[model samples]
Target: MGVSLRDVADLAGVSVKTVSNVVNGYAHVAPATRAKVEEALSRLDYRPNLSARNLRRGRTGVIALALPELDAPYFAELSRFVIDAAAEQRWLVVIEQTDGSLERERQILDGVRDHRVDGLILSPIAIGADELAARTDETALVLLGERIHDGPADHVAIDNVRAARDVTEHLIGLGRTRVAALGAQDSAVSGTAPLRLAGYREALAAHGLPETVVRVERYRRADGAAAMAGLLTGGDRPDAVFCFNDLLALGALRAILSRGLRVPEDIALAGLDDIEDGRYSTPTLTTVAPDKAELARIAVDLLRRRIDGRSGHAPQEVRAGYRLMARESTLGR
Candidate 1:
């Protein structure tokens, strides 16, 4: 017969309830008891039956992690971080991609009432206030990225406005004007897009420049290349471009190279979210770096607390400050 909780408890010389408490991380068990239980579990190779445990405790020990797209490097990295953090706490993560759709995000939220997961960690794209408010009551949901309604759920996110502004300022400091901001999805009602644009404008305004030179495009490399092409073909071309993301920046780089324009000499490019590829690309990207791993740690921590019915430990609006990484793309130094 396979080893069970009872076998583990017997080997550990502790009551089965004590072993259970240790397994569940109930926080009431003594250190010595926990050590004994852990040792016993290791010796017996005991793995708790998660389904049976869920049935007994009314908790799935699982969280729903929803993002816009897994294809994006930012979202993929974020998911990896979140999954790792959840694993540390003995919880499992179920990932879902909503594709930045309002209806799909609503559907995921509605699934909470059906007990699909013990809690939810959502990065919503086009959620309405009513929908956000409706979902907050029944489930433990922690909002990420854009600020949703501030009713019941906890929020862990970067200050997108400030981060974006700082990145813009870095480009400005490189002595480049006629700056262009790129990557604003069509039908994007979320504040993240505009907030980033606002930052770009603010940077321009600080330098006594106008903000009329912006090209809104979908959040894709192709969109970025097309937008850049249009700007170059037009009469007024920006000497510098601050893209919303690394992917867009990559596309911009492609467009610049295709047009036989020398980066940092003819035009400089910068972006946010310093992905791995950014570091390795020819004329390495200049961008704003977010503490991605830390963000994931905080998100997982918040979700776990909500599931445990604990409150008031919320880390209030962590900035996760951005670092302006100056690379050859902007100005070789």
Candidate 2:
């Protein structure tokens, strides 16, 4: 038979109720008592009976994480952090991909009839404020990313405009005047691109530099390659490039190398999101690194509070922190 709460309590010299309270994450438990209970749990390899616990609590102890693209390294890494944060609270995470489709996002917002999970953490790419405001589902929701600002949910994200400006300023500090931005998009679905572009423009304007933007349908390697190729063949070439994400920057690096032009010597480059690939690229990559672990922790904690009826009626908007990581891409190796 599996070890039960009674076994843990017996080993810890505490009442079963105390063990139960500690397991349930009650804040009132004394630190020493909690530590004792935790040690006992570990010693006995005690696993809580989630089915029985959920039956009593009227919750599934599960949360859904909806992301636009799991294939993207940034999103993939963020998902890992979210899963870790959820696991700390003894919660299970169900990952859902929206494919950056408005219809799919709307479906997720509208359809929560089953109450299969206690709450949801969504990184919306296509959904807007109107659709979010129209959501009728009572399921606790937390949002990630810049899409759907001032919506009816707890939100967590890094400051996109500020981060973008910081990256652009870093390139400018290196004495690159003609810096081109590679990830501008004409689509109304995503809010991230526009905010980033605004930051780049703001930085350039402050330095009295002319703006050069290349629009792409998507922020992919192919798009970056195509955009860089066009920029290279143009009448006036930029002295530097600021890609919206590391993938695009890496792609641009490929295009630069294909043209037999040296990085930093001929043109400096930078990007955001600081994905793993950036660290190992030929010229490396200078990028903005968001505190993804902290972001995930904050999002999960907010959702947990909402699920436990602890969060107040007023929605929360939390901004996570980020820093610029300079590497070989912009600075000489």
TM-score versus the correct structure, for each prediction: 0.85, 0.84
Each prediction's RMSD over C-alphas, in Å, is 4.0, 5.1
Instruction: Give the range where candidate 2 is weakest over 10 consecutive residues by summed lDDT.
Output: 107-116
Candidate 1, residues 73-153: lDDT per residue as tens digits? 889988999999999987889998998888888888887767768888888788865656655456777877765435346
Q: Give the Cα error of residue 305 in candidate 1, in Å.
A: 1.8
What lDDT does each candidate get?
Answer: 0.80, 0.89
The C-alpha local distance difference test score for the whole of candidate 1 amounts to 0.80
TM-score of candidate 1 against the unseen true structure: 0.85
Please, what are the lDDT tens digits per residue for candidate 2 over residues 47-156?
Answer: 98877777787798889999888998999999999999999998999998888888888877666547678999999877777778777788999998674566788888
Write out the backbone clash pairs for model 2: none
